[model samples]
Target: MNIELWWPKLTPSTRVGLLENNGDAVPPQVVAEVTRAGGSAAIDSDSEESDYYLSDEDVEWIETVTNEEEPTEGLILSKVRRT
Candidate 1:
């Protein structure tokens, strides 16, 4: 999924909710939206040692969007399967 395109489409409230609650508290409607946007939820089995490493582009995008040099944990943006 191209998160750059999907991120801008989210409602401001939803975006704030996501940032505040992180992935765990994301509503089903938002999860559906993410799925429809070609994003998948992160599996519990996944680990730092897994193959699903975020690219430099993903990291840069996250930093830019969150405006944090180090983004908080559990962001759905971090879960996006960039293709």
Candidate 2:
């Protein structure tokens, strides 16, 4: 499953965790769930073969789901420039 496909199924807390941790520090259960959903590669930042950078739509969805106004200065998403 693509991140876009599995993302909406994630619990709010799980989504917030991903946003807060910048794709790092994912809980093992969440990882397992993502793997089951075929999105394991999407969270593996260390995998050279992984092309899992967040898209603009992903960022928008995160903000909307989390009710965040915008990426703050210290948020990792703030540094991501989706082209």
| Best candidate (score: lDDT) | 2
State the C-alpha lDDT per candidate: 0.50, 0.53
* Stretches > 4 Å off in candidate 2: 41-83
Q: Against the hidden true structure, what lDDT does model 2 obtain?
A: 0.53
* TM-scores of all candidate predictions against the true structure: 0.45, 0.45
Residues 20-69, model 2: lDDT tens digits: 65534456676776566656534445566534445445555556435545
Cα lDDT tens digits for candidate 1, 1-83: 76555665666665555544443434567666656766544433545432222234544555555565344434444333222
Structural RMSD, model 1: 9.8
lDDT of 1 at 13: 63
Global fold similarity of model 2 (TM-score): 0.45
Report the lDDT of model 2 for residue 67.
Answer: 56
**What's the lDDT of the predicted structure labeled candidate 1?**
0.50
